[model samples]
Target: LQQVQPQGEDVISGNVSLPKVNVRGVVSNLLRQRETKQGPERVGQTDSDVINLVSMLFDFILDDDNLPVPVKALLGRLQIPYLKLAIQDYSFFSRGGHPARKLLNELARAGIGLNEDADHLKKDMVFKKIQSTAQRILTEYEKEAVLFDELLHDFSQFMQTEVRRSQMIEQRTKAAEEGKAKAQLAEKTALETVRQRLDGKTVPEVVVRLLTDGWMGVLKLVFLKYGPESNNWLGAVKTIDHLLLSVAPTEDDAARKKLFNIVPILLKNLRQGLNSVSFNPF
Candidate 1:
């Protein structure tokens, strides 16, 4: 079998243009040349209809905009082979489950969403696979139809693995986005809590800086780990209130005694909170 070289064509603005020629005449000439060597065979009305239908199918495949230009070109190489198949087997038209028909469908589907401007066309896995498949059929196929089934099975497995990998990447991206949103909310809640407590209260510059910068981070961390209603969150908030009261000017004897009593515990709690966030007290 002489390898049918792909006809010349040009692609412009995502459309392909082939030299004007009669498709039926081309098919007839190809069959005539083959018959010359293999002995003359009568061309009947059914063979003519099959040739015309295969030509139309090729025309549709070429004109399809969804397929990339390179993909369309690769598929065009199969025209002569497909024409021969359809003429020999009438079931190529009637049987939708034909291996050759399914292989064609899989090739087109695989090429969908591939960018036309991709660099190094030969390096692309899908394009390479399609190119290899078309070349194998062109050079190796004679009367064996099982070749189509073998190619289809291998291609389907590759595509299935690719689909699973893409799904996993997509899921990880979604999870990262959700985690970012949750952290942002937690930070906002932490800021508002600190601001409300310090509002209308005269506190030392050191205390103000500590709560806004270091303690606020601790609150955000606690909120993220144990939620707003957790005992850990309530205890952290209470520590902030006690720290403020300890800094206030108190002349009452009872109040001063109480402040002194709680001062050691307040310092201990503050040290632990700051350490949780890796904040240095010094």
Candidate 2:
């Protein structure tokens, strides 16, 4: 086909316009993509397709190409919402796994704004900036509503997964702790019963000697009292105190004499009570 050049300032002005070939080509491709369904055939889409159909249009409006390299670079930073939307759409429709991630990453790199120094700054500034930008977008660009909705849907899905994972991890950790606690309590109760049976003999003293006293004994007593129905908080406190007293800095001689006297009396009383027991004989 023959092309007619649009009349403008004379060619002598040394200015000429290109055929707009790239722009027109891109627009046609965009229309075609809209009509196409997700399938193996569409997997061959190129980087230029994404850039031309989306990023280039935004660039054309913003006159971004005329900006300094650093400024243009800043403008091209990734918008997470947009990238996530594109990723989710491609993943769901096209079943493009690694390719989708790569394409999304490239598009994100090309058209997103940045959060420079966000780590160093206070949160209020960041929050206010986001709110102001969103408000501006709402007022200025009603046509972009579909894009915003898609982005929000992607975010909602992400948050739902995040919440579920956190709940699952919390539940598993709680269950593990409860299991450990139950096992410890059972062991303590068994030990306490053995101590009670040998109370009048040297066995209780031997076990108490083995314990280092302080928090360990406190924990033991707490388990004994709170772990079983027969146990009470008061009993826990008394047990802790008794174990502590045995290891306290009091005069050693006085303490030993008291313990010795108490043990013998307890033993004698227990033996006499046993002797007085009546048995039925035929």
lDDT of each: 0.80, 0.40
lDDT of 2 by residue, 71-160 (tens): 222222322222323423443224444432333333333323433233322232322333333333333432233544443445445546
lDDT of 1 by residue, 46-78 (tens): 888887788788788778899888788778777
RMSD (CA, Å), candidate 2 to true, equals 19.3
- Can you list the residue pairs that collide in candidate 1? none
- Candidate of highest lDDT: 1
Q: Per-residue lDDT for 208 in model 1?
A: 92
- State how far residue 97 of model 1 sits from its true place (Å): 1.5
Worst 10 residues of 2 by lDDT: 5-14
**Per-residue lDDT of 48 in model 1:** 83
How many clashing pairs does model 1 include? Answer: 0
Considering only N, C-alpha and C atoms within 3 Å, which residue pairs clash in candidate 2?
A: 77-112, 78-112, 79-112
